[model samples]
Target: MPSPLRLHPDRLLPAEPGLRAIARELYAAVRELPILSPHGHVPAQLLVDDEPFRDPAALFVTPDHYVTRLLHADGVSLADLGVGRGPLTEPAARAVWRVLCERWPLFRGTPVRFWLDTELADIFGVTERPSAQNADALYDRVAERLAGADYRPRALFERFGIAFLATTDDPADDLAAHAALASDPTWTARVAPTFRPDRYLEPDRADWCKAVDHLGEVAGIETGDYAGYIAALEARRRYFVEHGAVSADHGHDDAVAEPLDARDAERIYRSAYAGQVTAAEALAFRRHMVVEMARMSCDDGLVMTLHPGSSRNHHAPSFHAYGPDTGSDIPRRTEYTTALRPLLERYGTHPGLHLVLFTLDETVWSRELAPLAGFYPSVYVGAPWWFLDAPDAITRFREAVTETAGFSRTSGFVDDTRAFCSIPARHDMARRLDAAYLARLVGEHRLDLDEALETAVDLVDGQPRRVFRL
Candidate 1:
């Protein structure tokens, strides 16, 4: 007989029975609240098109590195899972499901396991654990359900109670899709974009020169010199602001921010354009650009977010074949106190700036990030990200930062996932973990239950919307 599959009601709660009960009650109150996804990787076109998802594999496996990466690690090839190839000859939905089910053990004890199980049990009414035998049946059931109007992207967005969602976009992007979504009077879904200028700003990027050229074209500015390139970037930022982007995202290997003299900056820009920049020159250019970005944010009124410290593309072979964001990225140690001093010195206390910082380096939570965000008027700590976006990590983050920075200094949770279906699950997990944490504090008499409940509601709804100005 197949093993019993059931979702525990008090999942992710404290081990203590009384605390667990309180957590469950708190979670129930916020569990059905509208999702406020201020930052994420979902494309704007999905909401704009409002199309039905093609199939289970296309919907779940292809775009989500979280699922595919785990499957690949368990001796399943990406090709077998219908990922990164032009198209699969056997792109049969059931075949892909079989491959995943046979290796279900790979996700054991993982957050991905929690999400997948939740999706299967709650969304599809599947009480049996996925396995080689049940794969086709599961596939047929999901496929049938997906064909319904309720499974369409826009309808599910409503069902999921997503109040507002923001998609990440490059500086050169036209954002015509966002415009299209905004103009659709029949659709009330609020979809917007966030500016991500990493490629154009980071000199070490492989296609830096090409990216610069694209930026120049989009901004209608010449890019033959450093001054012109800066002008182009500024112009595009304004364009992004016009298109309803209120936040700018920067992803880098480190958070080093330095201001350079015009001469030094020009020299570095020339080297970057010529594809002859040294590693030090690249770092200097990126650092200088960060300072410039902050200045732009100050002028444009766009909230700035720096997501640093990921050692991207650790698996060389997979990276070469699949490209970035394919689950090969790994976190590394990061320094912020000194690295951000120069930028902080210039804009750290700026009245007009809003800069949120994120890290995969948890070591800095209490020692670096919390203290920095506590002091700097412009800085707020982004939620734990990437590998640290798990239940234990979220608990540790709140515990580590609350003493020094307090709740107000930190930005609330961002799902930051490409998997649209898992958005609610991710947010639900964060809410439950936060409720559990708050209940412990209440039990210890550190905080009153009324205050805990009020704060819980704010975290689930108000904080992110207000912070990102949604």
Candidate 2:
């Protein structure tokens, strides 16, 4: 028989009895707070359509790069996991589940294991730890539950206690699903779109010209020149705002946002338009556009979220076969101080602008990001993101940034996930860790218990609504 699974009540609390008690009190006070997912990758159509999940593997394994990448590390083929491909047959899906269950031991001590354990036990009544012996049975059990209304996407959204969910979308996207959701009187959940303009900013990509032209067509602007392209983007930002978008999201190679002279920018744009741009010119144009985007945010009132330093599609083979976000995007050492000086100097203190900075590079938490956010009224430090969203890293983030920027200047915890079910688990982890951190402060007399409780609540309820302007 598989070992019985049970989540410990004090699993993430501090070990000291006094501190643990304080954490328990703080956690209890805010554990049930509604989730405000200000930034994530979950497609809005999933909730708009409100379909029952197809199967356990599809719901939990296939869409989650976190699971597939680790499984790929242990010699499982991405093909076998149904990645980069269409839906799998029932037997094929079960085979993927078998692989995950057989290799479950490999995930020991990782946050993946923690998230999976919490999801299976808490959400699905999965009481037995997964193993090859129980793989088929567990799959069948989840499949059965998924067929029920309780497990449907919209129902699960409500059950998850999500008060607000934000999905990242291209600026050119029509957001038909978001529009449908907004119009449906039956749907009460608040789902918003975030405008992501990275592809339109990159001139080196083969599809850059095509995407720019398409953006012009969608926004009803002429894109034969630089001014028209900028107009097209500005128009789309307004369209997204009309349909309930509050932020503009950028994921670039770095954080640099220096503006170029009008002549230089137009020259680079003309070269790019003619498909004759050099690599250096492409970077310059992209960097210049980032500055322009900040100016647009200052005018439009959309919060500017800068998530930089991801070396996306690091493995050519996987990228070619499966496309991006298949788990090969690796983080690199990033320096933000000098890179962001141009943009910060220009509009970092603008009253209308809210710049939320995210990084895969943890080294900048105290050295650069905290100091920048500490002084700038408009800048906010985003939560520990991507590889750093794990338990220890979350703790490190708090300890590193709190002294300089404090709680108010920090963006509340964002899940940044495509896996819908993992939303609550990720946020719960953050809340638990925050409670523990605050409990330590209260125990050490750095902060009183009442203040800790208030901080905990604000971290969950107030901070996200304030920073993201939800």
Candidate 3:
């Protein structure tokens, strides 16, 4: 007989029964709340086209680097797993599933295991444990369901209880898709874009000059000089605002920011354009641009989000084959105190600006991020992100920062996912973990149960919406 399938009644609850009950109650209150996904990489066209998802692999596996990377690490080839290659035929899907199921033991204690199990059992109603023998059957069942109308992107978005979803877009992007979705009266989904300008600003990026030229074309401004480049960026910011973008996103290897005079900035820009800048020059230019971007945000009234410490595209071969965001990116240690001093010193007191910071470096939670956010009028701490987007990390973040920065200083949970179906699962995990933590606080008499319940609700839904201005 097949082994029985079961899910923990209090999956992330405390070990004790009474506290588990409290956590369960708190989770129940916020579990059904609408998700406010202010930062994510889901394609805007999915919401624009309002089309049905093709299949299970397309929906669950192909776009998720977390799933694919784990499978890759376990000796499964990306091609055989139907990643970075082509569509998986039914037989190929079964093979991939069989391999994954046999290696399910690899994910035994991982958060990915929780997410996959939740997606399998809750989303697809698959009661059987995934294993080599049952893998093909489960794949067939999920594929059948995915072909149905109920599994379409828009329907699933509604079913997932996502009230707001924001997709990242380059500043040079025309955002015509966003415009199309906005004009469609039947589309009730509140989909918007976030401004991301890394390619145009970073001098070391391949085709930096080409990206700047594209920016000029989109913004209808000349890109012959530093002043014109700034003008082009400003124009794009205005266009992004018109198209319902409330936030601008920055992804950097470091949190470094610099203050430079016009002469020095212009000279650096010239070198950047000619591809003659040294590594130090490139970093300084990028740092100065952060300050420039912040000053622009103050005028444009767009929230600024900085995600630092990612050494993006760590694997050159995989990147060349599959392109960016294929799960090869790695995180490095980051410093915010000194790195962000120049930018903060200039705009730290700007009440009109909203600057949200995220780091993969957990070391900074108490030492740097919490203090900076606590002191700066414009600063707010982003959720525990990327490698740290797990239950333990979330709890640690609350514990580390709550005493100094407090709950209000941090932006509440944003799914920050490219996986659409995982949005609810991620949010559910966050809610359960947060509730469990708060229950512990109440148990210890550090916080009242009533206040904890209220705060739980705010953390789940209200805080993110308000912080990102959703």
Index of the highest-lDDT prediction: 2
What is the per-residue lDDT of model 3 for residues 1-470, given as tens digits with 9 covering 90 to 100? 44545778689889888888889889888988888888998988887776767667777777788888888887776676677766667676667667777777788777788888888888788888877778777778998888888888888888989888899998988898889888988877778889999887788877999999889998999997999999999999999999999899999888888878999999999988887888888888888899999999999988999998988889899888887777789999999999888888889898668899999999999999999989998899999998999888888998999989988889888778888888888988998999999899888889888898999999977777777777
Report the Cα RMSD per candidate: 1.5, 0.7, 1.5
Query: What is the alpha-carbon lDDT for the whole of candidate 3?
Result: 0.86
lDDT of 2 by residue, 1-470 (tens): 68988999998899999999999999999999999999999999998788889889998999999999999998888889999778889999999899999999988887888899999999999999999999999999999999999999998899999999999998889999999999999999899999999999999999999999999999999999999999999999999999999999999999988899999999999999999999999999999999999999999999999999988899999999988888898999888889989998999889889999999999999999999999999899999998999999999999999999899999999999999999999999999999999999999899999999999999999999999899
TM-scores for every predicted model? 0.97, 0.99, 0.97
- Per-residue C-alpha lDDT of model 1 across residues 1-470, encoded as one tens digit per residue: 66656998889999998898788878888988888887999998888787888888877787788888888777777767777764444346567878888888888888888888888777777788888777787788888999999899888888889988889998899999989988889778678789998888778879889889988998899997999999998998888888888799999889998899999999999988988999989988888899999998988888999999888889898888877777778889999999999999998898778889999999999999999989997889999887898888899999999999988888898899999998988888899899999999988999888888898999878778767877
Model 3 alpha-carbon miss at residue 183, Å: 1.5
Worst 10 residues of 2 by lDDT: 106-115
Worst 10 residues of 3 by lDDT: 1-10
- Candidate 1 local Cα displacement, residue 18, angstroms: 1.6
Q: Given candidate 2, what's the lDDT at residue 122?
A: 90
lDDT of each: 0.86, 0.94, 0.86
